[model samples]
Target: MNVSRRDEDGPRRVVVGVSGSLGSLAALHRAVAEAGRLGAEVLAVLAWEPPGGEFGYRRSPCPPLLAAVRDAAAGRLATALGEAFGGARPAVPLRSLAVRGQTVPVLVGLAGRPDDLLVVGAGRGLLRRGLRPSVAAGCLRQAGCPVLAVPRPALQHDLDALHRRHFWHLPEEPVPAR
Candidate 1:
């Protein structure tokens, strides 16, 4: 993939998936920091499922309430970005989009172009087993550019300590070489 800087003067384009989760917020923060460092623009995306069904026969059009929720979600994402960037006023260029579809397809389509990076949060256990993997893993496999998966930050110090303790453990070692 195209990992190096495309142009010395131009800003890079970063697309971050925001789902209102803690991990998603972490991803957003990471994207903002990276963008700020690279002088890159950020495309904050929020994907929501359509209100209607596959066919239009019996299903109704999108309701106003649902539309409002989507808008609110997008707004929250923008707010989060602003907070994460320390109220820096969106350095390069910040664009927020609310799409009606699955997150994976939307992000993949967004990342298909060059000079773009995809950033997403490592989801909770349930989400990891389902949509999260589809979006994160699928984007990594399909996106023409590089994908960054930012794991959720650990909250407690004990958890970090435990992680450090297990960090040196080897999976293939035998029990005391017995």
Candidate 2:
């Protein structure tokens, strides 16, 4: 853990990963709340990877296709951020980054600074809770600083609100771990 009183550049900030998932959105809100209390900033990262299999088999991509994919990812990030913040930017600064990579490694990389707090959702689905591991679990294992994995109840509440306002669905919010 970084024992430093303050970061070299400035005050330490909260870093969160958002993927338009209920868990991720909840994590974003939690990060924002932490930042507000700490009087810090927020680094919102939306990491994405291209389609695999046939798409990955080829080394080079057509410029137009790659651009289109990146644009779509950016749009998703924007929408997620808007929804997470209730359509208004918070009082704290929120920097959004859309990168091309696996979610865990990308988020872990951003959490390299000892002062940085890595926040992620518990993720979704039966596989995430059971058969498959969650991205939050991966970041917790490798992140340099503290990791906060927001529980599914908070996530479910957020999803429920969104469902009411935007006609969305909360299909797989897990029960809080006992």
Candidate 3:
């Protein structure tokens, strides 16, 4: 599924993954604020595993409870993001999506394009191993564009402080090549 907003003079597009964790929230907020500053659109994604059996042992249908939980979480995430970034007016277009599949593949597929910026949280959790040779790392290695992995706690605090100060700037130059 694709969500696109056509604005002749708007910010670029960014994709943020929210895994219903504090880290994910931080990433979402950061993405929103950054997108706002850059005049970009936001794509908030939540990927959940559907109810099923291992391999092909016994396939179970997605229970209503699981579906409800996922739906509610998605809604809450959207609302929270909207509230966090929402201001006097809708400065940025934030699109929230709930997908059924593995997190890494879903995220990579969502932000694989060259035009999109993939934003993810970094820590120790399902979505934390983005820097390692896991799904997140794989996406970073294979993604057509750049991948921004924000350290959940520290990065979130820094962003909050920066917002309050109302002074921030991107790095002047890229990090020296390894």
TM-score on alpha carbons, each prediction: 0.66, 0.77, 0.63
In candidate 1, stretches whose alpha carbon ends up further than 4 angstroms from where it belongs are: 1-11, 52-58, 62-66, 82-92, 126-133, 156-178
The full ranking of all candidates by TM-score, starting with the best, is: 2, 1, 3
lDDT of 1 by residue, 1-178 (tens): 5554556534577899987666777888788778887778888888776444235413665568566767776787667666666767655578878776678888878766577788988645553476435567767778888899988777533565676678767477666854
- C-alpha positional error of residue 161 in candidate 1 after TM-score superposition, expressed in Å: 14
Better of 1 and 2 by lDDT: 2
Which residue pairs does candidate 3 place in steric collision?
11-39, 11-40, 12-40
Residue-pair clashes per candidate, as listed? 0, 0, 3
Native-to-model Cα distance after best TM-score fit, residue 177 in candidate 2, in Å: 50
User: What lDDT would each prediction earn against the true structure?
Assistant: 0.73, 0.81, 0.70
TM-score (C-alpha) between model 2 and the true structure: 0.77
Identify the candidate with maximal lDDT: 2
Task: State how far residue 43 of model 1 sits from its true place (Å).
Answer: 1.0
Winner of 1 and 2 under TM-score: 2
Candidate 3, lDDT over the whole model: 0.70
Among all windows of ten consecutive residues in candidate 2, which has the lowest summed lDDT? 52-61
